[model samples]
Target chain A: MHALQQKIREEGIVLSEQVLKVDAFLNHQIDPQLMHAIGAEFARRFEGTGVTKIVTLEASGIAPAVMTGLIMGVPVIFARKHASLTLTEHLLVAEVYSFTKQHNSMVAISPRHLGADDHVLIIDDFLANGRAAQALISIIQQAGATLAGLGIVIEKSFQAGRAELDAQGYRVESLARVSSLASGRVTFLD
Target chain B: MHALQQKIREEGIVLSEQVLKVDAFLNHQIDPQLMHAIGAEFARRFEGTGVTKIVTLEASGIAPAVMTGLIMGVPVIFARKHASLTLTEHLLVAEVYSFTKQHNSMVAISPRHLGADDHVLIIDDFLANGRAAQALISIIQQAGATLAGLGIVIEKSFQAGRAELDAQGYRVESLARVSSLASGRVTFLD
Candidate 1:
């Protein structure tokens, strides 16, 4: 966690008044060593939760989710943002709105991959408005699976994402939580 | 490679006469143990290439690329298929046509992530028509980076992907190469 926090301090860039860009190391260009460490940390945090599968959204979340799955020795299932021709017919689908992209998109998973017997841990790179996480949770619920917990790499605490998810009764854990970003400076939540 | 071949034999589904769906363990729902094994195999194969970074396209490619990067102790930079607020201004972009989706999409990477000194190993889930791989190669060339090799999980030998890449003088290695998938039966190339 300290390592992630340090990386955030060193590499994270503040854009405008609200956006924190971590594409240099976390999203676009990934630091695999740091990813492995973060995965191990998540595995350690959720040590005995009986997690059967790791769920995440496509694109950014795949790396850390796969890393966590590798460390925890569980299967990682990512919801596809777009339904390709190869996608299965029976699927659990949920619509999510992206504040960054300003578009509504559907994330889907094969019904055959998740079921009532599975316990899922949702992972993502960033937790902003919590729309993406909620969408994944919806898919998990539709599949009748247990929600072990949610693991996020970087969370914007100033946003209502945490409160919204907490109100929904989902336990959320984030490596780094930013309380505020003022004048290009980040303040962490105590 | 035997382990991968066995996995393909067991879980892979023949969706159509041309489509082989391994979504259960490869792309949609990932088996982390098998991914690690595949990553280790890739690392072993590209042992002395001095690969400074692992390059991959997003969504499906992120998992295996990150896994290989972790094993090789290098950074993994994935090309973005969709535009986002976090993407940098200057980028290396390429257009690739998807055989599965039946559409052409642009993939981009921040120029800051790649450079002339970097030797990159391009990783992907499938190599069908070689369009995606060709796009990636174009991006690397634009950055003046060295192409160490290309690593693919599954190669459709019946297609012209391998031949096109080989014609371009790029070294490609796939764990499983399918010679044919006619009538829902998969035959591996020797």
Candidate 2:
């Protein structure tokens, strides 16, 4: 966690009061060691939580989720942003609005992958407005699976993502919490 | 590699003469241990190739790429299929046509992540038409980076992807090679 926070402070670019770019090590390009550390940290944090499956959104979340899945000895299911020829049956679907990209996309997972007996842990790269997390949660619910918790790499604490999830009685664990991105700088939460 | 071949034969769904869906493990829901084995296999095959970085496309490729990157102790760079707010400067771009999705998407990577001194190993989930590999190769060339080889999880030998890359004199290592997918059955190339 310290390493991630350090990496964010060293390489994270603050575009504005609301935007932080971590494309150097995360987002676009990934630091494998950092991801491994993140996976271990998530495994350590969520230890003994009965996590049967790891769920995430496609692209950015795959690396961390797979790493966590590897350490936790669980299968990882990534929700597809677009419809694929291979994925066209028994889908649990949800609509996600990306505040960053400013577009709404459908996120779906096949019900065949998830079931009522599974305890699903949702993992992702960034938690800003929590729209993506909410979408994954909805899909998990649709499958009649139990929610283990939500794990995040970097969280924008200034956003309503954490607060909303907390109000819903869902446990949210973020490795790096950014308190603010004011004046082209990153401020971590304690 | 035998394990991978076994998984394909058991869980892989042969949709048609051209399409074989491994969404049960490789595409949609990922088996972490199998990916670990794959990453180790790729690392073993591409060992001593001076692979400074692992390059892959987003969504499906991230799991294997990150695992290989972890074992090889290098950075992993994933090209973005869509434009992002955080990624907008000095990008090396290429257009990739997805035969499966029936669409063209621009794949871009930041110049900051790749350089002339880097030896990039391209990794992907599937090597069907090889358009995605070609796009990544183009992006790597634009950065003046050296390519180590292509590491594919599954390669359709019946397709032109392997032949084209072979004709180009590029090294390719696929864990599992499929000879055909006829009559709803997957036949592997020995």
Candidate 3:
């Protein structure tokens, strides 16, 4: 966790009051060592939670999720942002709005992957408005699966994502939480 | 590689004469153990190549690429399919035609990730008409990086992908090579 917070301070580029880009290490270009550490940390936090699957959104979330799955010795099911031709048996679909992309898209999961017997741990790169996490939670519930917990790499606590998710009775764990992203500076939450 | 072949024979679904869906274990819902084996197989194949980075296209390619990067103790950089807000520095873009999606999309990689001094191993889930491989090659060439090799989980040898890439002087290694996929039957090339 220290490595992550340190890396964010060193390599993370804050372009605006609302955006913190850790593209140098976390997303886009990834450091596998850091990813493994992040995964290990997540596993440590949610070790005996009876997690059956590591579920995440596609693209950015795939890396940490896969890494966590590897470390936890579980399977990772990434909900597709776009339903491809092969993903015809999409059992559950939830619409999510992305602050980064500035658009809403339907995220779906195949029934073959998740079911009532499974307990899922949600993983993502960042938590801003918590739209992505909410979508995954929706899919998990729709499949009759249990939401073990949510693991996020970075959480912009200045936003209401954590409060909103907590109010809804979902437990969320983030490696780094930012209390404020004001004046292009990242202030960590104590 | 044998386990991969066995997994294909067992879980892989041949939908059409040209389509083989291994979504059960390869893509959508991933088996991390199998992925680690696939990564280890790739690492074995490209052991002495001095691959500085594992490069891939996002959404599906992240798992195997990340696994390989972890095993090889290197970094992984996946090209972004869509340019998000933070992906403003898309230094290089390549047009890749998806045979499954039936459309061409621009794949971009940040220049900060790859350079002339880096040695890259291209990893992907499938290789059919070689369009994705070609696009990655173009991106690599643009960045002036060295291509160590191409590691594919499955290759449709019946298609022209291998031929095209071979003609272009790129070394490729596929775990399972399907010689044919006719009438929902998968025939592998010995």
| Best model number under TM-score | 2
Indicate the residue-level lDDT of B148 in model 2: 94
- Give the worst 10-residue stretch by lDDT in candidate 2 chain B: B82-91
| Candidate 1 lDDT, B95-151, residue by residue in tens | 999888889999998889899999999999999999999999999999999999999
User: Tens-digit lDDT track for model 3 on B85-148?
Assistant: 8888647999999889999999999988899999999999999999998999899999999899
Where is model 3 more than 4 Å wrong at Cα? none
Candidate 3 at A14: error in angstroms? 0.3
Q: Model 1 Cα displacement at B158 (Å)?
A: 0.8
The better candidate by TM-score, 1 or 2, is 2
DockQ for candidate 2: 0.91
Clashes of each: 0, 0, 0
Per-residue lDDT of model 1, residues A23-86, tens digit only: 8888899998898898999999999999999999888888889889998999999999988898
Judged by DockQ cut-offs, is candidate 2 incorrect, acceptable, medium or high? high
Which CAPRI tier for candidate 1? Answer: high
Task: Quote the positional error of residue B95 for candidate 2 in Å.
Answer: 1.2
Candidate 2 residues lying further than 4 Å off, grouped into runs, are none
lDDT of 2 by residue, A1-190 (tens): 7999999989999999999998888888999888989999999999999999999998899989999999999999999998888788878999999998889999999999999999999999999999999999999999999998999999999999999999999999999999999989999997
> How does candidate 1 fare on TM-score?
0.98
TM-score of each: 0.98, 0.99, 0.98
